[model samples]
Target: MAIKTWELDSNFKNEIAAMPGGEGIMKCFQCSTCTVGCPITELEPSYNPRKIIQMSLLGMKKEVLESEEIWLCAVCQTCSERCPQDVRISDLMGAIRRIAEKEAEEGKIELKGVRAIFEKAFMHQLEKFGRMYEIGLSMEYYKKAHGGFFAGMMAMQKDYQKLGMRFFKKGKMGPKSMFPDKIKRTGEVKKIFEKVGE
Candidate 1:
């Protein structure tokens, strides 16, 4: 068995350090507090904040940016909360996500499905009733992603079924429940993203 080595660029660290909240990645001392604090790790074995920081520190940009683990993060803030160095690990992950998106647009990366799912799911909510309608968004997301089998199966869970029927019966599709005023900000958010690229 042989271990393959990735050609890490020397400038990668400097580039990542320039992103917002990225400076703390360099200060991490491998205390493992972050890994212990992350609830996602309990569910998803691949979701390790410590390894992510290590990769970032080593300038493994390709691995860090292309990982589904980054997007799967629940943004629970526990990693930062438990850090002995007070590093903002969650924000660092967010910076990596932004960089990944930029890399994707430039043809340097190909994480299209991740962006597509997120955008379509988000836009469906924005266009329909303003903020997220859990049932509607999940249904639309599944229809587009998995052809509804997975979503349908998940919806069959007792709690999910109860919630789904309640929402369906209540028909919570209005201004008060979904925040109609927030609908106008969708374009603004899009424009902000546009400027971020420019």
Candidate 2:
């Protein structure tokens, strides 16, 4: 395969470098530790964490920024754990996600299906109960992603019962309520996000 070199704008490099975990791209040696440690790469070759860093270093911002593959990363932390250079692969991906999310906010990007559904469910939970109710959020997310009853029928047979039990259990609480003090702290965090227009 011929390696493609993108002609990226200098401002893009500066933009990415200013991100929290994006500053170490220039120091990478292509050791491939991040690649080898990423579990998702085993199933999806397009998600090479090391290659992501290389693309970032080369300032292929468009390709990197427009990717749904970055969203597929579940942040399992294996890549970060195995990185010999101590590069925070999860954090770098988070920085990239912020860039993509900013573009999404500007209407330049449109998230499809699961991503949009997930986002809506997440925000709904935050706005309604001040934290995520995992079971409730999951059901809402599934319904939104599947588009209605017919699409989720098969999945429901396998997982819905379990999730419903969790959701309706008398003693269950949302993630925030599980820790009394953390709820207050999370409210403070939400205030900070609101201040930043998040």
Candidate 3:
């Protein structure tokens, strides 16, 4: 985390401020309100919103963009509600994630965790079906996460078996859930995704 002069990009903060949802980046005044209010920070001290913002402002572009911490945000907006500066910290995190995603897409960096994988799976379901298909999403996520369907099932078997039984008993999951019908006019969903450059 050492601040090497050569590693800094002086315009990095401005770059973030110019992005949608990141317009308030310049408003953070090191108040630490976002960190204090972040529920994720409470359970995982390493996921520090304040530190990420500080790093972003300091022009630590590589560190911030490559961080696994940015993807950990739950997007609950507690920090935004509590910010004295109206920084919209939750949205700021989203902005950062967008940038990270762009970087990964362009091959500037490799994303390092299941969060991104899960998001892709979730979004694929929405784009393809115009709504969530829980069984399909789970299968896709597991397949991508573990490299294959059988491998993923084996990895999650014990815990998922118990959970699956509970869900079945409660009528939350069953064979009927496996064959979810796609929403009418699913093309609209793809159009929406395309509009957002997804």
Candidate 4:
């Protein structure tokens, strides 16, 4: 579909550049270095960092914000390491995601995938325990992903039954794993979350 003229927001790039890790966005010069080095691009041809940057520079605000391509970046930083202009493409992707998330939260747009859900679940576990709690993380992920506790449990069982059994046999997961003691510095962890307004 062709983009309408009014859909463009000339200030969009500047808005992103103002965000942390986004300051280098304008340094990009359409060099394909980032795209060339992007592991995701090799696996998924539709995920083009160079194209995303060019769109952003061209003020394709809505397209860039709502595109699933932004979420495909794995943040492995190969692109950042290879960028001759030091665009920090991995960090740039993160800045874009942050904006997308903000827009989603404000009801301005809908996110199309489970990545945001999984991220919230993961962060909730981290914030609560000051470290990862796999059982809790799994439960939370399924609950949000599938919509409820019972449904999540059923889905989890169907998906992980064999793996769960193996983990149990290897003492990797069990009843005791369900209620791990929170880390000693959990308060410190909460403070960090507070500082970030998470």
| Candidate 3 structure, TM-score to reference | 0.93
TM-score of 4: 0.93
Candidate 4 regions off by >4 Å?
Answer: none
* Candidate maximizing lDDT: 4
What's model 1's overall lDDT? 0.71
Q: Where does candidate 1 stray beyond 4 Å? A: 1-6, 112-116, 119-164, 171-198
TM-score per model over all chains: 0.69, 0.71, 0.93, 0.93
RMSD of 1: 4.8
Off by over 4 Å in 2: 1-7, 116-120, 143-162, 165-190
What are the per-residue Cα lDDT tens digits for candidate 3 across 13-36? 898888889999898998998898
Clash pairs (backbone) in predicted model 3: none
lDDT, each prediction: 0.71, 0.70, 0.86, 0.89
How far residue 33's Cα lies from its native spot in candidate 1, in Å, is 0.7
Which tens-of-lDDT digit does each residue in 12-38 have in candidate 2? 656766889867556678899988867
Model 3: residues >4 Å from true position, as ranges? none
Instruction: Give the 10-residue window scoring lowest on summed lDDT in candidate 1.
Output: 172-181
Please state the error at residue 83 of candidate 2 in Å: 2.0
Summing lDDT over every window of 10 consecutive residues in candidate 3, give the lowest-scoring window. 152-161
Q: What lDDT score goes with residue 76 in model 1?
A: 81
Candidate 3 deviation (Cα RMSD): 1.5
Whichever of 1 and 2 has more TM-score, that candidate is 2
